[model samples]
Target: MDSPATLEHYKAGMLLSGAGDSTGFKRELNYSGPDIHEAKKQLGGLKNITVKLPDWSVSDDTDLHLATAEALATGKKGEELLQEVALHYVEGMKDMTGREPGGSTIMGASMLKPGTEGGYRIPYNPESGGCGAAMRTMFIGLSPATLEHYKAGMLLSGAGDAIGFKWEFNYSGPDIHEAVKQLGGLKNITVKLPDWSVSDDTVLHLATAEALATGKKGEELLQEVAFRYVEGMKDMTGREPGGSTIMGASMLKPGTEGGYRIPYNPRSGGCGAAMRTMCIGLRYPRPEQLSSLVAVAVETGRMTHPHPTGFLGGLASALFTAYAVQRRPITEWGLGLVKEACPAAKEFVKTAGYAVEETERDWGYFTEKWEWYLELRGLSSGTGPVVWPDPYGPAERDKAYESFSWSGWGGSSGHDAPMIALDALLGAGSNWEELMNRVAFHGGDSDSTAVIACCCWGLLYGTEGVPPGNYSNLEYRDRLENSAEELYKLSH
Candidate 1:
């Protein structure tokens, strides 16, 4: 066997690896065979090759390799070492102008955290079979290894809740823009408290999340969720909790002989149910968990808003969250969701002994709403150039939403809450600022709509574009992150 590698050997290996990367990048050598032979033959002999600095640049793989080496040189261990490596990898993304970084590498690096256990590596991704990992890790013989999207979803949902909650009581309609101007313009809005305290939306969402994180399933999970909802009501000071939710939770009897769910209430169709169900999707995100998602979402929804319109909105939010976590196309996120999940939702209503007749009758209301939304966005025909339209101004938004049969009160009811939120998400594309402007500064129940929208956005794009001040000091941030981490562990 050969002798162990010395300092000079390591140096030589790193330099050569970087040089190889630069040469391969410059040659555009992703594949091999006669094509490479022809290109090399056309270039003549090695005497003509003049690989120099600045001109022949290495790819992001080499940059990340250097980062990894620096991380290893820090003399840290365990979580500290992992944190150092994550920081270096993320910082390396700043100046990758022509580096040709792998998309998976960027995504994985963007999501790395600092302290939590098992937070070093990203979760399994079947499609991430790129050479980025191998190229960057060539120098290291051994090392360590996330559901970062779900975690971001959880955290940013609270951020959206806080910001939107501030606007709920402060501004309405066209005046919200002026309010935004008063708060040092849109970009200057600090996401810290007491200006941006999270309301009942996040509290109830956390209750659902913490309950799901307990790893209970079926009736046990539902019971725990109901218990938490009831318990959550005790600390509603300054939360501005909704009356519908308060009344609904007050009547719940968890661990009782019958069940934790209340009877179907035709009168209740508020946004309360939809706002808190984002965590349900995070808990059950796999294709196999569709039934579980349907059950949990519908059951938890019925716990408060038992009407089909209300409960179905909860199902929609959860389903959309799952779709976002799966990285499904944004265009498909709206109409495709209604097509896919409606059947499962209907089946759950029938088998779960809900008011089947009422659900069958009122379910069309929710379905038609989505269909109308798709039609409005020019997504219903499937033949047209389907682009998620730009976000409408407040007046235009409310004017269009008036046709949804909700008296122009956008996002007031459960059906329209998730709908408006989804519209914001689609329109905003990858822009966090645009997402907040569309969903959080809207007319009715902005906080409720924002909670769902931000969760889906976070799942699709892990808070990369969101300003740090927006979420760094968000209330209950620790609880939200921990809850997300637990749910991510369960899902992954």
Candidate 2:
């Protein structure tokens, strides 16, 4: 802990270096000499002041810190304050150097700049772990609040990696298209696309990141951010967005029913909600944060998937992911958490346009079916099975497979995909390689399912748990690495 006197000295040194000056520090070493001399005079001839140094042009780091202080003094907090500070940092840097700051500062600041569409910032630079952010975080020091913010940032980064990497393969609906082909034909073949692209999933995740960066929270923030994502996607792609995003966008449009009051279909329970809720879990990883976590998860899910099953699946995924990130024995507690999240899910569905009783009845039926499938595979909510069961051996396996409307059992239903992922993980036991292969071969929603499974596995086993080959060929691998490293730093 730095003493107040030492902190004051440091502040004086920064001030003497022309930290906030837009024009004073332009002359490099010569400019610093005059500033330091003036500082000494102002300090009543303090001879020991270090500001007497000849070279002292403060970089954007100083400007960012000063801007952050100003934002804080003005009652700005969270991502919103960060955005304002970034804007001020950029302006100050440009005024001093006639250009934007270099390195990761520029990269991060550019994304927050006004007029920059959220779509363009997808696949954030993986190589942005420079000292820019760390250097300006002196004010955070050693505090629980600082750790909380760092953890939130790391979680956002991880979500970006998980969603963005999955998007690399699933963009343009290739996985779903291939699953459809296999189902239509008798071929047991799976297709892996060569090129990588992004979709509404990645766009929505980035939008949430932007919202978080600007200190937005709860339902209102998510709704506003989600609408921006829809509009940005429409502008960039010049086509109507697909998947649950279509419904989400509909809810935001002002019309006969009034904006934000539009009805969301109760049956459209796609995996979009589950895929994007991991960040929320990471941001709120404590047992105490569970209520707020569930609330935000439900709000985010209702944006696209108003169904109880839809949002419940997302909530379960987030809670499980958070537990995994905390290195809790997910295999031991995952099922129980799912059960606990169910009541909240049922309550949220009551607010939907569909008949509350019927929706609850349907939800109960679906969950029963899901639990039955788990029991048929010897994966009931009890002791862990020692051996991985063969999916092709039993009559129950066949029945479960047949129950799905698709070849890979890769139904677009949110609950179904998460169940599949959980089953695969529990079944694989300690065999990570086999788990990866099985997930890859699953013909339905392979990429999305794989993303969920991989993220969980990564959380449990860390980076070393993930095979090199899995991400070595993937785009933006560095960014994923950077995110993982930051998370590790924050957690420790």
Specify the highest-TM-score model's number: 1
What does candidate 1's lDDT look like per residue over 241-351, in tens digits? 876788789889989944677776787788888999998888877666788899999899989888878888888888888777665556676665687777888888889
Residue-pair clashes per prediction, in order, are 2, 6
lDDT of 1: 0.80
lDDT of each: 0.80, 0.51
Q: What is residue 403's positional error in candidate 1, in angstroms? A: 3.2
Candidate 2 residue spans exceeding 4 A from truth: 1-194, 235-242, 253-261, 348-361, 391-408, 429-432, 465-469, 472-492
**Model 1 TM-score, all chains together:** 0.70
TM-score of each: 0.70, 0.53
**Whose lDDT is greatest here?**
1
User: Residue 65 error for model 1, in Å?
Assistant: 17
Clashing pairs in 1: 122-146, 123-146
